[model samples]
Target: MATEAPQRSQLSLRPLERDGFTARVLRSLTAFIQTADLKPGDRLPTERTLAAQLGVSRSTIREALQTWQAMGVVQIRKGSGTYLARDVRATSLHVPVTINLERQAVLDSLELRRAIETDAARLAARRGRSEDVERMRVALEEMEAAYAEHGFAIRQDRAFHEAMFTASRNPLYLQIFQQVINRISDAFNESRENPFVTEPYADESQPDHRRLYEAVACRDEAGAVAAVTRIIDFVESTLRHDE
Candidate 1:
């Protein structure tokens, strides 16, 4: 006799309102991405499977998946299982704990940073004023001081980057970067305020800042580009990652 296949078991998200099912699904999905280390092109379980895992109606899962699709977060195929889209703005920056985002988005952000910052660093090397270098040095000092006292220098870190952008002497770059900062401001605020996320990095980053300044101050365009690339590369290599 042929044996019957066992049914897949259903999971639960207790204390959830039936009406709030869709919202919960979205949050749960992103949290899974952040925690599970999911990445672009990674296949997600089927809608039926997600419905079971989330303890929600299959229709609810379908709706949430549709929303994710619209948001460019996921790609769906008729027979092939759903997948994370190749490109995403992780950190839920657009959505909302938005929390620490997944690795893909962090990598994406870093790539963007490298392009923009390297140009800025190079331009600053050519056109930067002595005052600009002074400001960077000051920001570096403040970063060191804050890192020494509080063990994390979020404000000083941002200030240094802001100063770098300003030194680029390009209003367009500054304008574009301001928007990027604004988009991440919420996540940045939460991360810095918590202190837990910022920890384990004090006394580091000093040399990178100094090197960047020296490159710019000495009018070393290629060197400035390398210095800035190194800085962003460190960030890309470190900090946030799970999948």
Candidate 2:
């Protein structure tokens, strides 16, 4: 006697009609996985199907899937399909942060960074290796050089923060920081001119990055936290001033 193939579980996703559609799709997918009791290695519905179910564009589905892939929530194989990369029941996945050029959103993102990065800086000061400190130094130098030549060091500045996150010896911190940075970059790219990329902002912010690196290098945990706080506070104030 032949046995029947195992049936795949169905997902019930409602159409989203709100701003930040990509973020909402991600949240909806995460909720579905939990409510449906999806296990690791379980394949997800195709992008086409998900888009239809969510009443969103294929591109939106792809973007949300890509974000999940980055977070290690799902694994996408070309020609095959997307699958849950881990057991959602065991792991807690926060909804990835999304940003826009909106004033309040930008301020909220800065606050989020302040909360995460300050603690990360303190951890890095306590536990960072020599190599980790070296990475921060190199990134800082590159940022300074880039700013001198181009009047903007957005890429280099991001590199500096990434180095800091790595130094914290926490993979989750790096992952969260990358998601926030990616959203911020998208917001800036959509705008005609990125305020954060301006000379005035970069000039004001560069010293704080150096201070953060120095504090981490010296294993000054309190100083590290203070430096990170100052950097975020400056950005928040700058944004408020513009409004």
Q: Output the number of the TM-score-best candidate.
A: 2
**Where's the lowest-lDDT run of ten residues in candidate 2?**
3-12
Can you write out model 2's per-residue Cα lDDT over 1-243, one digit (the tens) per residue?
A: 996643444447889985788879988887777777678998888999889989999999998898888778889999999999986642555467666647688677777778889999999999999999999999999999999998888889999999999999987888888887777677677465667767898889989899999999999999999999989888788777877
* lDDT of all predictions: 0.68, 0.85
Angstrom error at residue 108, model 1: 1.6
After superposition, candidate 2 runs with Cα above 4 Å error: 1-24, 27-45, 69-90, 98-101
Winner by lDDT: 2
lDDT of 1 at 212: 85
For all the candidates, what are their Cα RMSDs to the real structure?
Answer: 15.2, 4.1
User: What is the TM-score (0 to 1) of candidate 1?
Assistant: 0.53
Model 1 segments beyond 4 Å from truth? 1-103, 192-199, 240-243
For candidate 2, list the clashing residue pairs, or say none.
none
lDDT string for model 1 (38-62, tens) is: 6798887788867777778888888
Can you give the TM-score per candidate against the true fold? Answer: 0.53, 0.77
Q: Give the C-alpha miss distance for residue 192 in model 1, angstroms.
A: 8.5
Model 1 clash pairs?
Answer: 37-242, 37-243
